[model samples]
Target: MTVQLPPLPEIHHPKIQALFQKSDRELVTLFQRHPEEGQYFAAIFCRYGQVLYTLISTATRSPVQSDYLFVKTWEYIYHEMRVLDLRVTTPRLSLQSWLINIAAMMINRAEVPPVEEIQYSLKDTPPVFWCYLNQALNQMAGNLRLVLLLSQTFQWSHTRIAAYLHAEGESISASDVKQLLVRAYQALEDALPEDIRDIYLAQPAVTA
Candidate 1:
């Protein structure tokens, strides 16, 4: 004989809908001011939870790893939110990018089984383009490279990056990261072919 399971509790859909109406920045502020009201935090999670999960899953390609990273990322976000200074930390990308950045660091630390390498070269151009890009990235200064990688690869905000670098004994600030990122992009653009440079120029401005 099979035992009957109890039905799941109904979620307050109206409350969730109301939460969705508020912007991420607004929700964050509300949560910060009223930490006891968990709905505000729940609302923020509802907005970006699925997107973050998808990103983690795609990167890790393992259900167990993805689930672990997903939980860890949210934990970091919650802790950071408590100490976050809204004046300095602008949610330029509406907090989604910031969340993804945290997830990326977790992804980087997780050990994954190695996969076979496959190289594919487009027939449209010479292979030197790829080489040039790699060379440009390699030749960048250590600090410049760190800022570029953290900003471009991880989508970390300038203020977050500044704190990370400062903790490592680097004398830097958000303004410095912004300037260094601009210079790094310029150098990379100059190193690329004109056509590729134009494509890069057409892309949207990088949110700090």
Candidate 2:
């Protein structure tokens, strides 16, 4: 079947556009060699960090955790650069997607919002539960966290998430990703306050 691609959104910032043009290896090398280079990297992060963080935070529902995961993602990229090599034909999906995937994995490893606690939310009704739910998910590991963020917060399609994983050299099915995402959302809602549970539940499902 033929697929329809989304309209290309403009990356208007001249400086950031330049950064994106460089290979990941190049950017990482720059950051690693110069202690002061962090300031420059931070500028890049600051430019697009919110969009990335918001995508992550919404998926996991935690601002505090998103902050931590975001920083960790950059560090990992820097560390990976030491021995990593990318072929010219690598799958292309903007640098932000790459970073967001790392952030997601970090959240998954943390394993916050245990299955048992998720079930608890389905049973109880509390005021301002979504706040707590958001907090709990934020505490989870990066992978699961990013999955939720991209699927729920950014409203990306499961196919898109799958395509991203494939680009990163990870093998996962879009259907499998969708299943995990469903569980993540259920857990998130379970953790929310009963008062707004219906509202949260009623919100439109995320789409590409």
Q: Candidate 1's residue-wise lDDT over 45-99, tens digit each?
A: 6566666767777777645545555655666677687666545655554477777
**Top candidate (TM-score):** 1
* Per-model CA lDDT versus the true structure: 0.62, 0.52
Count backbone clashes in candidate 1.
0
Instruction: Compose the digit string of candidate 2's lDDT tens values, residues 39-137.
Output: 234334444555555555565554444444444454555455344334432675455656666667776775445333332221132112233355557
| Runs off by more than 4 Å, candidate 2 | 1-26, 32-36, 81-94, 112-208
Q: Given candidate 1, what's the lDDT at residue 96?
A: 72
lDDT: which candidate is best? 1
Candidate 2 has an lDDT of 0.52
Q: What TM-score would candidate 1 get against the native?
A: 0.44
TM per model? Answer: 0.44, 0.34
Among all windows of 10 consecutive residues in model 2, the one with the lowest summed lDDT is 1-10
